[model samples]
Target: LIISSDSRIPSCGNSTLTGLDGDFVRRSKWTQLIPNTTEATAAAEAAGSSRAAGFMRLTSHRVTIQGANSATLQVNSGQMKMGMTYGFHLQVFNIYRGSNVGNSKETFLVSVKTEPVIAQIRGGDDRLLPIGSLTESKILIDASLSTDPANSTAKLNYNWLLSLSSGPTINTSSLQSLATEQMFFTTVPFLYLNKSSLISDSVYHLFLNVTSRRRGGKAVSSTSQVLRTTSTAVPVVSVLGGGIVNEAIPITLTLSTSSPSPTATYLWECTSQNLILTDPTTRSTSLDSQNLQILPSVLNGGATYTFQASVTIGGATGSASTTVIVNAGPVSGSCGGSPEVGEGLKTYFLLGCTGWSDQDTPMLFKFSTFSPTSTLELSSYSQLSSITTLLPARPSNTTIISSIQDSLGATSSFMFSLQVSQPDTFDVQDTRDLIKIRLTEGDSSLASVLISGTASYVFSNRSIQNTSQQASTVSGLVSLVDSLLNSSVSTTEAQVSTPLSLLQTVTSGPVSSLTTSTQGAVLSIVERTINSSLNSFSNAVASSTLGVLGNVL
Candidate 1:
């Protein structure tokens, strides 16, 4: 780290510190007095073989003066914990030639005790921790090692005894002094709790000031601010139930906070080993249909499940989370429908009720007959419970017959479609087509009519196939009697040549293209032909009201 000053203090080279536990100290963001020193850069350089440079960079503010030249460094309460006991420690090392002209011997003073609450909020210079009895050189101490001035009747003070006998006695007092007259290499020790104290998680604002005690009894202060860690709010999440597979249960989460007014929302995270939603971006806490629609077919087996819920309130966010074991239940599927016929198959349908009982949630039903070759399977559409099946894929000889009963005592019949394929039906070079249909309603008395001729085909991907092969139905039905009646009104059936020719003339021309002359002539001929045909036909069926009506009219 590097220490710089716009004042008379000359810019000293750099220094670094190693073996310092940063995380255990505080979570507050720190700034370097010298712009070149950053946490990462300082840590890397400090870890090197040389220790002198690292120490100098860490302690930016240092003073070098004549015998009576002394300075004091004030670490305010804002740069530290307000109520908790802290140790403001500093390291003195890596001394260099001083540019200032002063006594070969330099004495420095640092407040080892706390002073009065000088500012509205208690300040730092008042809470300095004394080093090695205040008269020793290069001493280390915790916050509690020295008395706090903010709460003490004694004024905060410390004196550094430097021996200029050697080339230059390391100026340790510069580590805590505010005056930057001379460059001194030192390491500013980070303040930490002698004993941990509870601090609510919140934002705390503060700054740092540097001052020096001189032989003349005068003091000087610096102009730099620092923010401290008043408290830290960690995110927490809570999940209500020990998550059970395929089980529908209520889940709730709660989060705790340090700051009273935290603005936040909940996030649910399912960290199951199973193939749950793997996309993190798409996963969220909302219980909307798109996010919560878990199909009955997905649950498989036992797996570890965990969910994390997070909320951000008033710029402070907290998350709560929990983990549980998810045990899967038995799988089920639909068997058959309608008569639900076969050697052994059955089917059921939804009863359509407003509510269901807890017991009914996982319903159980028995089959009328057991199939040695086939198994019972639940159909999702029927909404039946406890359906079982032996096959993982579609069975070759699958069939089912079943009945459903509603809450109102109404019974309905249903059928399950048999599998379309047979085990030995096809080979590599041969092809066989099969049609399957599941009939939910059937009238046994009705004859089986083959409506396969009405089937339609759809072409896709250069392949032509019957899309609705099972439902070969026709659009409309015409009765035999109605068919005969329409045939008699046709122009092709006219008996007389003139009538036939006139009929052609009337029907040959488009309705919009026909002239008045053509229309009138055709009408006259049609009237004569109709009168003659009516008389003859009526005579053949004398009891019918045909000839008598025309004659009377």
Candidate 2:
């Protein structure tokens, strides 16, 4: 028997190895037998003469072909010598000896239809549709191209080809040049497109081509609908009022838009050192309004604050940010001075002093003094100006109080005293010398004198003569001389001697030689003589001497 096998059967029909008809067989020839006694005797003699003469055996077998021509076929043979022939028709047969038919041989024919068919493409819910605007920059297209006869035993290969068109009429030539291709295993495939690649304010059409194929078979292709791409306006956000600011100052921030959106939502966020703000929408530091207010203490001194404003419209977002530098306030200064001030003297009392400030704010200075009593207030521009206050005069030494106030309401205090000296002493001996010179010069016009420099004295009563009358005369003469010195005229000793001579003439006494020691005696004698003459010459010389003394006194 002869058996033949075909390799092309599996490619013709859709059948698996398990479903193939194994009983189908094709037989081309039957076994033939011939009897030979002499050959049998020779074989028996070769095998040992005891072997009896054997007869040749012949067996007949039949094979049957089943099913249609498109069906799968399987064949089984027992100990067959097989020869294969490949031709236009798939033939599988075997040749075998009747004695060797106990061995087994099996062959399977699996009929497979390798042609893949793509019936329809199922684009999932995420596909770009023509109905609404597109807010996102990127879009995803999930497409599934199904094949006919879901259980077909064909090894299929799939490809997803994506193309973009600006208009309704898709130019296949342009699509081929710019198409994006990808290989897939299942019917489902994913495709992505960036809106930046497309023109703005224009419509774009997307086409998905799913190509399905099998080995040694024709490729099948299907396409999706024209998916139009839409675009929405992007909102632009801008922040105002940023940069350096002082602590405790109001910081206001406003958010504006270059392009307005109808359904846009706003959110403002802020962060600073040691600051917290409550919001109704969010528990964190966020606000829904476009304008935000940061009160005093919301931002600490020497710290930085960051702000963010975000606008969302139609699933699109626009954002802007800014920073604020918080500066510290003016620092406090120092104020102090001594405790005592001198009277009748120019004394400088320090009102206050301070270090340089970072800003240009005026400092206030105030000064007050007791005893004489004075007050003043002034504004200083420099770092340390108007710090000293002058006190001209005071009745006694007293305390001078002062204070300074800065722009930030910080104050400093100071206190000092003004000391007054006692009155100066008067000089008497110097006045006596001046009076003596005026009397010696006979200048009665010389009267009052300014006695200055070192000498101060008080005069007392003392006896100048022995007799009562002479002593009285001496005392009166000295009184007259003192009056002359106290007056504003220059008097001479000659002027005094004339009066004495008139007195001596009236006394009718001999003139004594006047020495420095007996000068008082001469004046006393002259006074006595004048009194005696008041009776003798009928008061002529007495009136003259008395008149001169009265004039001097």
Candidate 3:
């Protein structure tokens, strides 16, 4: 009998084998008849052999398909490799081998070929590369064709094909691009040995093809998954950690985790065109000494600024970010100053006019502490008690007369000093009253002139000095000038007017701005009285300098 086999059945589908005996089988058998005992033994043997042959033919089919399809898969590894293979084998058993359509003694053939794998799956940006290998299965031929009889034609002539375990699996999406301050990593699963298989010694090589593309670009790297069978668990790494320390402001940062852990290192990277130092390791962060200091230039109008900081550990890196703000100092100028004693000490000296001017007199600067109480607290030295004008020595009140006669008569150019008895009365006076002086048109108290309190020192009776000789000379010059201007000389002028010898010139002549000059002379005399009695005044709770001013004025 001749028998043939078909290999069209799918590896995972139901397939059967049938046997056909021709007329040649009957003719050959008729001539080969033998004794009943021998024939019976041969029949039984043929029956057993036919059953075994049928069993082998029906069970020889093998099939294999990928766990994951041509779609992109994710795997974790360092490199890629190809030409490596891995597969899974499926064992089949004949369920209808005892059917009667054909004898059990049948021979069969089996084969397998690759099915066209569809296009690969689309991978997204930020996806990591996959690592591992591919697997292929093809039918194996007659074991019986071998030299060894132990494995006969009946044993190998079935539909059996060589089987392979599945290949390693990998990640096919969320690919990450390599950029400055960035890192990448991934996870992968590969084929594991099935200890339950009949052949325990079989090993499969895994191969893969890797193609990388930057965002919106074509593949830049393509390769196969390298063998990592001996390696321990591999983990995918990503370059995502960064940090910043803003010295201007307090340091603060936020950390993100790929997975939770008791402790994890975050990586951060920073780039500055100018570098103070470079650390070969931990490219995640580069800190310059300059960055540590908060520079005014980095700030806007001395306002706050911000940046980032990177963190790392033994080898792994993680990142956290924070912001910095800068602070500015105070502005400077000549604000003001403090006070001196009776003689006013020059206080705040404002330059450039400061939008104010000396009205008819020098600007009367007021002096006080941070706070002031009435005129007692604030005092002025250059008149201008109230008027806000910038004119100097403006007359507050003026008295005019066609003629005047008194015990001390007046002349065309009159110069005299009067002494007051109670000089101490000015002590404890308000700043407004400290330098007050009343100018009388003549020796009589009735006719008078009023000037700014600022220039009152010029007429202050307390400042008079008793030097009649100087007064006489001034009186002589005035009389001589009058005599030269007018030839008429009256003998009564001497008697009606005060004696020239009794008056005194308290101030030197030829002084600029008679108002200020006169005040200065008076102030000098008053300061002399205070200085002379400094010790005596300190000793006595109350002492009167009235005698000094009364005698001079």
Candidate 4:
């Protein structure tokens, strides 16, 4: 900075001592000084507050009176601080011995207002980097580490410029000729650009120009620095595939890259012993429908596996991996229970156990009975429940195909034969008569027989109070009896046999689950309706002398 005095004393409080031809004031008599109210002083104070150490400084401040009336004020910077600010008012004026600039004499400001806005650049790791490395093809340019020495409220405009070059030196004075390729502005002190904005093995220079106006619009400072970037671009590669699957399902994966070279090669690997990788040397590989259900004796049960893919691009190798989930297929407790069957309102209560997929997932069941005449009346929509009932109305040899499924659509199916025996043919009226006679007056008493066995459980959840209720309950009781004993079963000996072996299980001990009054009421309704007709028949059999009465009875 050079502060020059005019040949004529412009304005001052001291005596108007005008200088002539070659006369000049001594360095001691040159009492001229710039006051400390300039923007540079505010900038220095801001720099000191923002960081731990000094950023704005002058290594040398010397004054030399070159001519009789002019002088030069020198201010040089240390190694670290760089950008320059110029053409701002410094309040330079002629001063006399008695007329000091301020009340104190110790406050002379630096003549130059070196701009307080400093720009810096760093990588994602706080170091200059092409940081994201090769595989992901990413690059980060961060300018948040820059400095602004104005008031905290001042807005500094960050203008970034990118120049692709061949390691050329930068001339700060001729910055317009830097031949930049990309330029944009950001409001904050930080920003980053991606690898698509750069190339591999290429040189580039980054420059950030920061500007701000401070001191009530009286002062403005602008500064910038060239950022660092590496010559190599990140090599590009990607591996994609892996998802949830059920055991015994196939899996496929693919490896790819945009930056391929002649030396590029592909490799695949799977850590799981249960997994068999086909075409492991190619970019695409698969795991065929390998049953992933490992026995309890095996270690880890082999349900999850990791698939890795490696590829070389531009002489750089990168690897990627993903995890596949295999849920074990559902287990059926048995090849479907071989439960007994009956026809005509006979419900085949699946006697033994239900199937399950996993503890967390619900189970579903589907049944197929290969008999055209029989329609299955299911208790529910075939979800795995302990109380599943299948009603087949006609007798047939049914090849029942049953399958248990889970939420993920994995299923295990099995086949079993259900030999539904035709129920004894009877009219509703005849059945009522036969049941009444047998229970109330028939040789084998059965007033207590109907409500025994599984029917006890059925009646427990029902409300049975009247004769009509008792009648309906008895029908269900007969169905249970037939299903339990396979009672309608004929031709075991190709002829009729003794009846003692039948109905051994249907009688739940020798007692009924109903109250004594309820049992008597059921028997009274049966016997009263059949008593008159039976007495008339007895008279006929006794008087007509049709000795065939024995055969009818």
- Candidate 3 lDDT over 215-307, as tens digits, reads 233222111211122122122223221122222232222343333345444333232223222443312222521123232133322232223
lDDT score for residue 182 of model 3: 16
Model 3 lDDT on a 0 to 1 scale? 0.23
Q: TM-score, each model?
A: 0.21, 0.25, 0.16, 0.29
Model 2, 1-553: lDDT tens digits are: 1122222112235656335434334332212222233533333344453323222221122233322132232233222111221111122342233222222222221112233354333321112332234455554544433443322343444454444445445554544443233322334455554545544433444444444443234556554444444444446566777666666656788888755766778987664424445633323224877787776555676676667777887876666666666766544544445334432222444444444232313445555443221221222233333344433333345454555444544444555554533223323344445546755664432211111111001111221223443433333334444444334222222233223322222222112212233454445544544454223432344454554343222
Give the total clashing residue pairs for model 4: 2
Better of 2 and 4 by lDDT: 2
Error of 4 at 206 (Å): 32
Q: Estimate every model's Cα lDDT from 0 to 1.
A: 0.27, 0.40, 0.23, 0.39
CA shift at 38, candidate 2, in angstroms?
A: 99
Positional deviation of residue 257's Cα in model 3 after best superposition, in angstroms: 5.5
lDDT of 2 at 228: 40
lDDT of 4 by residue, 392-432 (tens): 33234655556666656556656677555433442334433
Q: TM-score-based ranking, best first?
A: 4, 2, 1, 3
List, residue by residue over 122-221, the lDDT tens digit for candidate 1. 1121112121112323222111122232333323332222122223223545323422321222122123222122122222222323233332243322
For model 1, the local distance difference test gives: 0.27
